[model samples]
Structure formats: structure tokens, C-alpha cells
Target: MLQVQGVFKSYATPQGPLAVLQGVDLHLEHGSSLALMGESGSGKSTLLHLMAGLDQVDRGTISIAGQRLDQMNEARLANWRRTDIGLVFQQFNLISSLKIDDNLAFQARLAGRFDPLWQAQLIERLGLGDLLKRYPEQLSGGQQQRVAVGRALASKPGLLLADEPTGNLDEATSDEVLQLLLDLLRDSATSLLMVTHSTRVAERLAHKVVLQNGRVADAGER
Candidate 1:
């Protein structure tokens, strides 16, 4: 469902042109999950940003669900992100002013894909039914992340992108969140591309890709 070919990306730093990705080739099949592993500054997140159309690719092609992301204008990219992609960040980017219920339904409503039944189901499955009236600050780190996951899936997005999704949680909490995420994605048949440093977390996915020095060092399917 996602494809990248011969991708090269760089940033203009005061020192010089800092290249982060070089001739990177990656692919994810429909309804398949892939974990991206890399050390700091290895271009893993940069690749993700390119796929999300949040950053311009210096060279190469990125296609998602047969749509060419590199060619899309900003407006089209924004719409595609809202309609086709579900993103979960390490920071749990929730609206502080909105309550839990509003936060979970926010993106879905914006995408015009809101389904009350589906959202309610998500809330229950994520163990968030009782916290709907609470705000982000009122919940623990794990609870906030659960709400983030529910929010991401409420829209029934074709692809889900998670960046260090469990980074802020403890080991046990991280495992719990990861399992919950995988279970939901499997049932929903949404493709996943996650960036993580933990081998245990990466092993839970169907496929794995490791990046090094701005290139794909290794990739394999379990």
C-alpha cells in the first residue's frame, strides 16, 4: 500500500547540506505492518514525514494506496492526511481544551468519517469508556496514549503511522499499549508503519526494516 523508491532527502544546515536519506527503497503491502528501526539521525522519521507528505522529498517517489504523495500540492496533501492517514505521535498530541470524548472524535469529524458506534466501540475496547468526560491532563500517560490510538482509528484510516508510540510509558504499559494497537489494527485491517527503537516492539509487527547512515541496511518479513 506504500512504496518508496530511490529516495534521497537532505536538509540545509548552517554547516552544509545534511543528507538524511540516500537511495532508500521501502515498501509495505496492503493490510501489512512494518516496523522501521534506526538509530538517532538515521532518517527513519524523515522517511515517515515524506510518506505523510509533511516534508518535500528532495528526490525519489513515494506512493500511498496508488496515490503519488510527492506530486501532491499542500492542500491535497492535507486532505489526504486527514482522510487516508492516521498518525499517532509519541507526545500524544491531544487538544488540552477538549475532553477525552471530543479528542477521540476530533479527527474523525474533521475527516467527515465520524461513526458514533465505531467510536464508542473503540472507547470501550481501549478501556476509555469511563474517562470520556476527563481531559488529557486528568489521565495518566498510558490513558492519554490509549485515547490517541482511539482517535487515530476512529476515522477508519487506510494507513496508520506511529512514531515511538509507547516511548513515554513504562515497560509494562508499553507492552500493553503495543498489543492493543496491534489488535485493533489487525481487526480493522489497517496497514501500519511504525518507527521504534525497541526490538521487542518491532518483532510484534509482520515486517521489519532497519536504517543506517541514511540507507536501508536490512529488511525482512517474519
Candidate 2:
């Protein structure tokens, strides 16, 4: 459902241009999950951002569900991102002012794809029903992240892009959250592309690809 070909990205430094990703190629099939592994400067997050259309790639093509992200104007990309991409960052990114219920429905409302039944199922499955009346600050880290996941999936996006989604939680909590995420993805048939540093996390996905020297060093099924 996603493809990246010969993608190159660089940023200007005081001395010169520093290339982060060079000629990177990768693909993820529909209803599959892929884990992206790399060291701190290996461009894992850059690749994820390109696929999400949050930033334009300096060169190469990124296509999601047959649409090329590099070719779209900002307006079109914004609209596409809202409807087709679900993003979960390391930080929960929940609205502090809004209660859990409002935060859960935020994205779905924006995308005009809100479904009460689907949301009800999400709340039940994520064990978030009891937290609906609480604000973000009032909940624990795991609870907040669960709310974040619920918000991201509320719209039923075709793809889910996660960046160190479990970074803040403890090992047990991380595993719990990851299992819940994988289960939800399976139910909706949504493709997943997650950037993580943990091998244990990587092993849980269907495929794993390691980045080295700005290129995909190897990719294989787990």
C-alpha cells in the first residue's frame, strides 16, 4: 500500500548539505506491518515523514495507495493526510483542554468519517470507556497513549505511521500497547509502518528493514 523509490533527503548545514537518506527503496503491502530500524542519524523518521507527506522529499517518489505524495500540492496533501494517514508520535499529542472523549473523536470529526459504533468498539477494546470523562493530565501515561491510539484509528485510515509509539511506557506497558495496536490494525486491515529501535519491537511485525548509510541495508520477513 506504500512505496518509496530512490528517495534522497538532505538538509543544509553551516558547512554543507548533509544527506540523511540516499537512494532508499522500500515497500509495504496492504494489511501488513513493517518495522523500520536505524541508528539515531540513519533517517528512519525522515522516511516516515516523507510517507506521511509532512515534508516533501528532496528527490524520489513516495506513493501511498497509488497516489504519489511528492506530486501533490500542500492543500491536496493536507486533505490526503487527514483522510488516509493515521499518525501516532512518541508524545501522546493529546489536547490537554479536551476530555478523553473529545480527543478520541478529534481526527475522525476532522476527516468527516466519524462512526459511533466503530468508536464505541475502539473505546471498549482499548479499555478507555472509563476514562472518557477524564482529561489528559488526569490519566496515566498508558491511558493517554491509549487515547492517542483511539484518536488515530477513529477515522479508519488506510495506513498508520507510528514513531516510537511505546517509548514513554515501561516494558510491560509497551508490550500491552503494541499488542493492542497490532490487534486493532488487523481488525481494520490497516497497514502499519513503525520506526523503532528495539529488536523486540521489530520482531513483532511481519517485516523488518534496517537502515544503514542512508539506504535500506536489508529487508526480510520475520
Candidate 3:
């Protein structure tokens, strides 16, 4: 569903142009799960941003579901992101003012695909039934993360982009949340590209890729 070729990205810093990715190539089949493993400066998040079309690439080609991302202008890409991709951040970027239910349904509604039945199912599956009326600040870390996961899946996005989705939770909660996310993605036949620090989590996915020194270090049969 996604293809990338000869991707390169660099940024100008105080020192000089800092290269994060160089001639990177990747291919992901539809409805599959993949993990991105990398050290701090390896550009894992930067690659994700490029893959999701959130950031522009200095050079290379990216295509999602047969649509060439490199060809889309800003306005076109913005709409594609809303309709085709679901993003989950490490910070659980929820609005403090919106209720839990509202936050979970916000993106889905924006995409014109908010289903009440599916929303109720997500609330139950994420174990946020009672916390629906509560605000993001009122919920525990795990609860808030669950809400974030729910929000990402509400629109039935074709692709899910998650960055350290379990970073803030305890080990037990992290495992629980990770399993929940995998299960939901599998059920929906949704493709997932996630950045994770844990090997155990990486092992559970269908594919694992390690980025190092601005190139792919490890990507073999799982």
C-alpha cells in the first residue's frame, strides 16, 4: 500500500546541513503491520512524517494506495491526511476542553465517517465507557492513551501512524494498550506503521525495520 524510493532529507543547522535519511527505500503491503526501530537521531519520526505526508521530503518519491504523495500539493495532501491516515502521537494530543467522547470522535466527524455504533464499540473496547464524559486532564495516563487510540481508529483510516504510543504508560499498561491496538488494527484490516522502542512489541508485529546512520540497518524476514 506504500512505496518509498531513494528518499533523502536534510536540515540546515548551526553547524551545517544535517542529513537524517539518505537513499531510503521501503515497501509495505496493504493491511500489514510494521515497526520502525531507531536510535535518537536516526530520523524515525522524521521518516514517519514524510510517509504520512505531514512533512515535505527534500527528494524522493512516496506513494500511498496508488496515490503519489509527491505529486499532491499542500491543499490536496492535507485533505488526504484527514481522509486516509490516522495519527497517534506519544503525547496523546487531546484537547483539554473537549470531553473524552468528543475527542475520540473529533477526527471521524471531520472526515464525515463518525458512526455512533462504532464509537460505542471503541469506547467499550478501549475500556473508557465510564470516562466518556470526563476530560483528558481528568483521566489517568493509560485511560488517556486509550482515548487517543480510540480517536485514531474512529474514522476507519486506511493507514495508522503511531509514534511511541505506549511510551507514557507502565509496562503492564503498555502491553495491554499495544495488544489492544494490534487487535483493533487486525480486525479492521488496517495497515500500521509504528515507531516503538520495545523489542517485544516489535516481535509481535509482522515486520521490523531498524534505522541507523541514515539508512536501514536491519530488515529481514520476520
Candidate 4:
């Protein structure tokens, strides 16, 4: 459902242009999950950002569910992001003022894919049924991350892009969140491309791809 071919990206620095991703090629089939593993500055997050169309590539192509992301303008990319992708960040980017229920339903409402039944189910499944009236500041890190996952899935998006989804939680809590996320993905055709530093966490996915110095160094079943 997602494909990246020969993607090259770089950024400007004092010295010169610093390459972040060089000829990175990867693919994930429908409903399949893949872990993107790499050390700091290995370009894992850069690749994910390219896939999400948050940044432009210097060269090559990125296609998600047959849509040419490289060809889209800013407005079109924003629309695609809203309609076709569900993103989870390490910071649990929830609105400080919005209550849990509104935060969970925010993206779905914007994407015009809101379903009360599905939203309710997600809240219950993520163990947020009772916390719906609470604000982000009122919850723990794990609870906040659960709400983030719920918000992402609430849109019922075709593909999920997560950047260290469990980064801020404790190990045990991270495991819990990952399991709940996997269970939720199993119920739909949504594919996952998650960037993680933990090999153990990467092993939980069906496939793994290691990035080294902006290139895809290894890709194999996990």
C-alpha cells in the first residue's frame, strides 16, 4: 500500500547540503506492518516525513496507496494528509484545550469520516471511555498516547504513520500501547509504517527495515 523508490533528500547546513536519505527504497503491502529502525541521524524520521509529505524530496518518488505524493503541491498535500493518512507523533500532539472526546474525534471530523459508533468503539478499546471529559494535561503519558492512537484511528485512515509512538512511555506501558495498536490495526486494512529505535519493539511488527546513513541497509521478515 506504500512504496518509496530511490528517494533522496537533503538539507542545508553551514558546510553545505547534508544528505539525510539517499536512494531509500521500501514498500509495505496492504494491512501489513513494518518497523523502520535506525540510530539517530540515520534518516528514519526523514523517510517517514517524506512519506507523510511534510517535506519535499530532493529526488525520487513516494507513493501511498497509489497516490503520487512527490507530485502534490502544498495544498494538495495537506488535503491528502487529512484524508489518506493518520499520523502519531512521539509528543502525543493533542490539543491542550480540547477534551479527550473532542481530541479523539478532531481529525475524523476534519476528514469528514467521523462515525459515532467507531469513535465510541475506539474510545472503549483504547480504555478512554471514562476519560473522555478530561483534558490532555489531566492524563498520564500512557493515557495521553492512548488518546493519540484513538485520534489517529478515529479517522479510519488507509495508512498509519507513527514516529516513535511509544517513545515517551515506560517500557511496560509502551508494550501495552503497542499491543492495543496492533489489535486495532488488525480490525482494518490500515497499514503501519512505524519508526522506532527499539529492536524489541520493531520485532513486534511483521517486517523490519534498517536505515543506515540515509540508505536502506537491510530489510527482512521479523
If scored against the real structure, what TM-score would every candidate get? 0.99, 0.99, 0.97, 0.99
Root-mean-square deviation (CA) per prediction: 0.6, 0.6, 1.0, 0.7
The sequence of per-residue lDDT tens digits that candidate 4 reaches over residues 1-222 is 999999999999999999999899999999999999999999998898989999988899889989899778999999889989999999999999999999999999999999999998998899998899999999999999999999999888999999999999999999999999999999967999999999889999999999999998899895
Q: lDDT at 54 for candidate 4?
A: 90
Query: Candidate 1 lDDT, tens digit per residue, 1-222?
Result: 999999999999999999999999999998999999999999989998988899988899999999999778899999999999999999999999999999999999999999999998898889998899999999999999999999999999999999999999999999999999998998888999999999999999999999999999999889
Candidate 2 per-residue lDDT, tens place, 90-158, comes to 899999999999999999999999999999999999999889999999999999999999999999999
Backbone clashes in candidate 1 total: 0
Off by over 4 Å in 1: none
- Judge candidate 1 at residue 57 and give its lDDT: 86
Worst 10 residues of 3 by lDDT: 213-222
> Cα miss at 205, model 2 (Å)?
0.3
Number of clashes recorded per candidate: 0, 0, 0, 0
Flag regions of model 3 displaced more than 4 Å: none
Clashes of 2: 0
Clashing pairs in 1: none
Candidate 3 residue 221 C-alpha distance from true site, Å: 4.1
